[model samples]
Target: MVDRLEQSKALASQARLSVLGWLADPQAHFAHQVTGPPAEIGVCVTLLAARLEMAQPTVSRHLEVLRRAGFVTVRRIGKWAYFQRNEAALADYKAWINDHL
Candidate 1:
């Protein structure tokens, strides 16, 4: 598990926060994917890149930070990597915020 400071650093970026917000309601934010259900398997990186209007590599770099910080979880399907918010980690972060600041 990542420390709170690490997670905090990951969220410092607006793009990363946007990714988390979108994943919070994947079905509404992202288009239905042929790879799998958005809510179940998570949203594809391609969709995220398109939605963010950024290059895939750039979006991927943001996602990698979140992944390392445990703010999001990834599921690999063939060549694609899907992502969703780590709700448990999020709850812990929220609780920490409520307790500390």
Candidate 2:
């Protein structure tokens, strides 16, 4: 349907894909946080921005695309936004690709 097509389009960007890959292994990809852990809440947006070597706004836009595609989930802790991969959504995406392509 149109929604699925739109979701597919949302994931078509390289930056979004990189975000997903980084989120896949948060512990390995990101540094340890004093607040707690990367796996507990999720990786912080600032950390993601630093790792990607892009501005926070640019990283945020890429995160938004991945979020719309249902590939990432968001958590708000205090004043920061954390992001992590959505395993179920990713599984669904893979299945859809297998079936449609």
Q: Would you list the clashing residue pairs of candidate 1?
A: none
Worst 10 residues of 1 by lDDT: 28-37
Q: How many residue pairs clash in all the candidates, one count each? A: 0, 0
Q: Over the stretch 1-101, how does candidate 1's per-residue lDDT look in tens digits?
A: 55888888998999998999999999888756778789999999999999999999999999999999888999998899999999998998999989998
lDDT, candidates in the order shown: 0.91, 0.84
- Write one digit per residue (lDDT tens) for candidate 2, span 1-61: 2268767887787777778888888888875766668887889999888888899999998
Query: The CA-based lDDT of model 1 is what?
Result: 0.91
TM-score per candidate: 0.94, 0.90
* Candidate 2 C-alpha error for residue 78, in Å: 1.2
* Candidate 1 segments whose C-alpha is farther than 4 A from its true place: none
TM-score, candidate number 1:
0.94
